[model samples]
Target: MSQPEPGAVVDLLGVLAYAELTAFDRLAEDARLAPTLTGRAALARMAAAEIAHHVRLTDRLVELGADPAAAMAPFTSALDTFHESTRPSTWLEGLVKAYVGDGLAADFYREIAAFLPEPDRLLVLEVLDDTGHADFAVREVRAAIVADRRLAGRLALWGRRLVGEAISRSQAVIAEHDGLADLIITGTGDLAGVGRLIERITSAHTERMTTLGLNP
Candidate 1:
C-alpha cells in the first residue's frame, strides 16, 4: 500500500496530467491504423483533445507549486503496464478499449472528486467531461456488430476483459498512492460508502456496455 499520509491536490492533478499525455500519444499512434479518412480524423482530434487536457493539467500543477514531471513520474509504470498488456489487436479493439477504459476512469474520478474541495473539484469534473467520444465508440462498434454478428461475442468478451484489467490496475494505483488510496479509504469513511462507489461505477459500466450493444 502507498504511504498513508495526507496528500495535496497536485498529486491528483499530476496523475491526470500524465494519463492525458499518455493517452494522446497512444491515440495519435492508433490514428495511423484507422480504416478510413473519417476515423483517422476523428482519432487525430481525440489525440488533440488529450493534448489540451494534458496542457491544462500541467499548467495547473505548476500553479500549485508542484513539479509537473515529478508529479507525473511516479504513475508512468502502472499506466504503461496496463496499456502494454491490453494493447488492442484490431481497430475495433482500440475503440472499445478507449470507450470502456475512459468511461470507468471518468466514473472513478467523479466519485473521488466528491471528496475534493472547491475549485479542484470543479476543475476535475470539467476536465474529465466525456466530449462525446463514448457515443462515437458505441455507434461504430454497434455498426460493426451488425455487419458481423460473431463480433458481438468477441467484443463483449473484450469489453469484459478490458474492465477487469482496469479494475486490477486501478486497485494497484490506489494502493501505490497514499493520496488516492487514503482518499478512497478515508473519504469513503466506511465500507458501505466504498461499496456504493463500486456499485455506481459498475452500474455505469453496465450502461455503457449496453449502449454498445454488448452484454455486461
Candidate 2:
C-alpha cells in the first residue's frame, strides 16, 4: 500500500484530536450516572485522562498548524447523532455504555494507531483508556447482572445497539472522510484487514459481555 499523503495525516490528526475532546466531555457527563462514590470517582478519573488526551492532541494539531475546531467539525454531526440516539436509561445501562461502547472505540483507535507515523502514532497509543477504568466497569456491570438476572437480555440488547450505532457512524466517517479512510487502509493494507480489526474488537466486546454474565 502506498503511504498516505501528509494532508491525510493532518486530517486524521484533526479528527483524532476532536474525538478525544468530545469523548472526554461525554465521559465526564456520564460519570454523573455512577451509583456509588467510588464508582463516580473512578469514572471521573477516566474522564480526566480523556481530557488530558484532548489537550495533548490539540497541542499536536497546533504544532501541525491545523485549526483544531475546524478539524473536529466534520465529525461532530455524526458523533452527536450517535450519542443522542444511545443515551442510557438507567445507571447500570450508563455503566454498560461507558464500558462496552468506549471499550470498543478504544480498541478501534489502538488498531488504527498501528498505521500512523511516529509521534502521532505514539500519541494515539498513549491516549488509550487504562485497565483501571475497564476493571471498574466490569466489576460494576457484573455485580448488577448477578444481582438481577433479568437485566442480562436488556443489557445485551443495549450493547448490540451501541455497537451497531458505532459501526454506522464509523461507516459515515469512512464514506465522508477520504483522508481517514486512506489512513486506515494505508496502515492496515486493505478491506480484509479492516474486517479483521472489527472482528477483533467484536470478540473483545463479546468477552466483556460474557464477563458481565450477559449473552453476546
Candidate 3:
C-alpha cells in the first residue's frame, strides 16, 4: 500500500479522538438510565475506557504535530448532533446503542484503517478495540428480550433507526472532511470498494442484532 497522506492521518485521528471523547460522555450519561448498580458500574467502566482511548488518539495527534483540540473541533458538532438525535430513553435502548450503534461506527473506522500506514493503522485499530461493552450489552439485551419478548420488536426497530442515523452521520463526516474521505477512497482503491466496505459494516450490524436476539 502507498504511504498514507499525513493530512488524512491527522484528520482521521482528530475525528476518532472526538468520537471517543463523546462516547465517554454518552456512556456516562447512559449509565444513569441503568436499572441496577451492576449495570451502571459496567457502563462507567466503559466510559473510562473510552476516555482512555480518547487520550491515546489525542496523544498521537500531538505527535503528528496537530493540536488535539483543533483537530477535534470540526467533528464536535456532527458527533453531538448524532448523539442528541439518538439519545436513548430507556436502559435497554442505551445498551443497544452502545453495542449496535457504536459497533457500527467502529466497524467503519476499522475498515478505513486498512488503507493507512502501519503506525496509524495500528493506532486506529488499538483505540477502536471493544471496552467489554459488546458482551455486556449482548448479555443484558438478550436477557431483556427473553423477559419481555415484546422488547425484541421495539429494540429491533431501534437498531434499524440507529443504523440509518449512523450511516448518514458517517457519510456527512466523510464528506465534510476531505482528508478522511481521501484516506478511505485511496485505501479502498475505488468508490466500489467503499460500497463493499459499507456492506461489510451493515452485515456485521445484522449479526450483532441477531446476537442480541433482535430481528435484523
For each candidate, give its TM-score against the true structure: 0.94, 0.92, 0.98
- Lowest lDDT sum, 10 consecutive residues, model 1, at 1-10
* Candidate order (lDDT): 3, 1, 2
lDDT per model vs. reference = 0.84, 0.80, 0.91
Q: Which is superior by lDDT, 2 or 3?
A: 3
lDDT of 1 by residue, 1-216 (tens): 233232546778888888888888878877887899999899889889988888888887787778899999988998898888888888888888889888898898888877777677788888898766787788899999999999989999999999988899888888887778777777788899899899999999999888888899
Point out where model 1 deviates above 4 Å: 1-6
**Model 3 agreement with the true structure over 1-216: per-residue lDDT tens digits:** 777778888888888999999999999999999889998999999999999999999988889889999999999999999999999999999999999998999998899888888788899999999999999999999898889899999999999999989889888988988888878888888989888988898899899999999899
The better candidate by TM-score, 1 or 2, is: 1
- Per-residue CA lDDT of model 2 for 135-210, tens digit only, reads 7778888888788889889999999999999999988888998877888876777789878888898899898777
Give the 10-residue window scoring lowest on summed lDDT in candidate 3. Answer: 1-10
Q: What lDDT would candidate 1 get against the real structure? A: 0.84
Q: How many pairs collide in each candidate, listed in order? A: 0, 0, 0
Q: What is the Cα-based lDDT of residue 112 in candidate 3?
A: 84
